[model samples]
Target: MEMRAPEEIEIGQDITPPILPLAFTLSDSSLHSHCSSCFHPLNPKIPKPKPNNSHNPVPIPCNSHCNSSLLYCSHHCRHADADLHVSSGECHLFLQSDTSTWPSELSQLRLALRLFLCFQKLGFLSPEFLVSGRIGGLMSNREKFDIPGRIREGGRIMCLARRMRDGRFGNVVGESATDEMVLCLVLTNAVEVQVSEGRTIGVAVYGPGFSWFNHSCSPNASYRFSLTGFIGEPGSLEPGFRVTPCGEEGTFKAWNGDEDKLTNGSCKYGPKVMIRSIKSIKKGEEVCVAYADLLHPKMLRQSELWEKYRFVCCCDRCNSSPLTYVDRILQQNAANHSTCLDLDHSLCVEEAYRELTDCLDQAITEYMSSGNPESCCEMLEKMLIESSKTEQSQPLEPSPSNFKLHPLHHLSLNSYMTLASAYRIRALDSDSDKDNQLEAFELSRAGAAYSLLLAGATHHLFSSDSSLIAPAAHFWISAGESLMGLVKSSKWSSIIKKSSGFNLSSLLTQRSGKCLLLTELELGFVLRDGFDVVCKGFLACISRISPKVWPFLVHGLPYLKDINDPLDFSWLGMTARHEAQALIGGCECEGVAYIEEETIWKGLVLFALHCLLYGGYLTSVCYGPHCYLIGHVRNLLYGGEGSSLSENVENIC
Candidate 1:
């Protein structure tokens, strides 16, 4: 519960259970569709009852005084929201006595106006309120406000001031001062409240304490909004490890409550926002949350941070690659083009990079426009197939440039990622079409496995940088999800059993050895100048796959745990130690006084290969440990350190 020292936090930790907004408004576009209080879908499951002889349709309140056609999940939410903000006469000023207001009008004015009304209602509207500094010194991007939209926002605030003076918003601060404070508050403290799946619901401001928490690309803390905090048996908490709330003793809810009323959604609590740590924090470490998606490529992350919060991120990920991985690729392509190769059989790396970028970009654009993942997959496959043809037509000359710009480059890896995402979607489709499901299942497995192989060669596991962790995790999660689907569907059960004669142990060993060679080359090419980008990818991959496999590997499904500790197979814990040692050049090979960087990299690669191979084996063996490859790899890695290969194989069989 107290994770001040470096520690591993489990997945789905309830950083913040659903909490009511302190000061919030529904997005103008979403007001008509979502609940005013909970901000969840208004009619997510239930349908409107059809008109009948004995039934009259209840009219939705979309008329006079309610300018926006707002809805709520229940009558309780409607009243709770009204009592909190609306009934305080804040919205009344916008809904004039005679004239109706448009949704756009509300959208433009809501944020600034809410700042005034909420403060006024709370009796904090004095001129000295700004000077007092009690309200955490309202922080906003004053410089960014002045750059582009300052005048426009200034004009809008002035207009709102006039409306307030003329309407029921009685005796708020003077127009100019009000505009200044509101602009500062909106720009600095407001947080976007979106649906759990990512649809923008609205913007809301948290309490001063919540606002003080800073942003980090690689964040240590996170929160989720809810109307009520969850209370259940300690072991039954939703996702994440069971964490005792900071002030609470052993458990959250005492046992005096009724047994039938202990569900997460049925709990009663207040509107305060809760925070939880995503990872361990040292005593002096800054606790930060990502303001944007941490998995985004670096350039995109930086651009959003600057555009939204007006601060350029200097986080480790941002610092590791200022140009972003994609931008660097583009730059490399351009630079390579400047010096054209003159050799007859030289397959120009620059040409391949350019073609791949252009083709993938176009394919992504088409997918975005059409919303068809299948079409996107087809386009990428076609590009790869065509590239294969070109590579065959002109056999590659083994120049450094050719080797650097091989067909199976990082760009090709990106293409594989895209294809994997598409097939994953197809595999998860709820539709009952058996042929489609079978095709999707097969494609998903191939796509995920190929992506993992490509991921291994990308220097993702070369070091323990947090930036690289996310992408690798994303790929592995995709692969694991697809593999789970295959195991459940039993599509490959017969094939797997029939292929028992295949020397899988040799195949895995050979593959892992090749992976190390490819990793050496990639490290030489991309990370020769910098090692910051190395193991972040591998760490991320393990982070994602660990919890998914934990139930099987750690808890061991009622059998293996009887013989082993539940914590013994923690890949994250193992890698964390490995990462720490590698950072300090602690790698030791036999007879070497000090291992060189190259040797250290070789050791790291072999370790990562083992992790990947074991991860795949565990996922596959979850079907039942009778699969022959599992024991082979286990014995190969842990032999003499534990039991013999024959003994382990006998146990499994």
Candidate 2:
């Protein structure tokens, strides 16, 4: 089944209204931090770190008398979720001390329990939910994962929930067929509920309005979750969308629950998902959204989709004859001194595809689980530079002659993002020490360099694929943040003043013409210019300003010294399309040279403003101006961090 556009849809237009989840759950990790219902932060007073990583999942507990780890952010949230929580037997499942369940499975398990209870209450246990290969009109995909072990576990969990509710604990077998179906349905259709700031707090299973949209490598649509959204009317925003099952006309199915019962607001409190067109769509075109990370190469994307969704994506991007340019660059590796490792699909599988991802992931996970940023920085840098592969024969000394990752390789991108964050945290750890301020400033400088590199490299790829705009927006905003942060540092001003006879304070205090230039640019005008024009100007601006500060940005960072230019990815030399870049006199031959600190300050500031403006523009197109990234950008340009979006959105222009 797939959903088709009812009418021609322009970019950024909503394809679906804010659809409420039929069943939802928070993972065990966020149990204490976020609300069990709306998934809001439990304590706004605690400083939340600027969002960097995109997929951090956590757990939450319901606000009930049950002995569960679930917590609520507010009394209102708790009240709204009361019937769904306590009456659904979900409050009982969390009370179990089953430390044996894998953390990854905990979310689906809890959600399956919640969904089963709701299904029973709503009389959805009929063939519509149980016997058919569908649950509440969403594909169950039970056949793919209905192994005896999975079914047994599902039944065991189902019985456990019952036992917990009845104040008893025992190993007893019960009617588990329906429970297994619920688990399979959730595993098949649940989408992660990621917040505006890019944290995956929970999962939600929506009806056919969203679940019917099929998967694609280069999708025309994308979705976001709004926890504070009010579900006043179901299907009220029904546009011209219709669901077609197997290319045949089929009635668009919505949950037929009583309006009064639904409007009572028992199940409307969870995150509400809104689907928007990321690309222009024709009236009859089938709307598609990515089910897996689009940044992944074809092999990994296929692997992920098959593993999670039980199907291969036959999208044009996936079926490209010689592999898409983006896919080629993603898998390209530098072996034996800057030589591209050209591997076909067979070789990619044989190579185990980025054997270093496991090692790099371990280093990153260790840092995330523990609070040692310095160690993480050292470990990631060594892994990226050395590109080590551990052999069972010689685990310590002998080299296996492994290949280094291409800058745009998924692993390399992950490493750069982690390094940028780790370095930022390292700088913050020492920012309070007066004596170590210069060292901290250097760390900040390095962090900013990686952020710039990440943004430029990703944007360079975004030129080939418009679908990458979502992530490109994030990288650009993050880059502007790191750069502007360094430029605003008092320590930065002191160093520039002492070394180059200029105080950056004037730039801050004089209310410079730069502010006027930024505010004068309207968002509507930006979208009118189209992404291509904005991208062209953005790359040109970065190329012009970055050379002056590149050396200074990477002054003390050994890992970054090798890259000649961040934006000029002409090194790949994949296609002649780069001829357009010649108009800007591409910075491929940029020499590593630093000017005085004062000049560096000016260059960094100019570079940061361009990044922020361009980044904000792309973000508005992808996630809208009201996104959390816009607020961060707004706060940097004006000191209006916590102001309402309506009041401050105009300044974003």
Candidate with best lDDT: 2
lDDT of 1 by residue, 1-653 (tens): 12121234432234333333336677777776766665555544455634441121222342225454656555555555554345433454445442233223344345555555556655555655555322323454554554434534443444454464456354333445555556556656677764332356787776433554567776666654443322332453333322222212222132122222111211122233445554555544555667876444566677887776777878765676344333233233222323346554245654554666788898888876877887887787666654432322233334434323322234566666677667666666622676576665555554444444444433233223333333443344334334434333435444344434222232133232223322332221222312232343333334333233323321312212221221121221112222322231222212211124232222222333435343332222121122223333344334324432222221000
lDDT of 2 by residue, 63-103 (tens): 47677767665445556776676666677766767625533
- List TM-scores for all candidates, in order: 0.53, 0.83
Task: Look at candidate 1 and tell me the lDDT of residue 387.
Answer: 48
lDDT of 2: 0.67
Of candidate 2, the 10-residue stretch with the lowest lDDT total is 644-653
Report lDDT per candidate: 0.43, 0.67
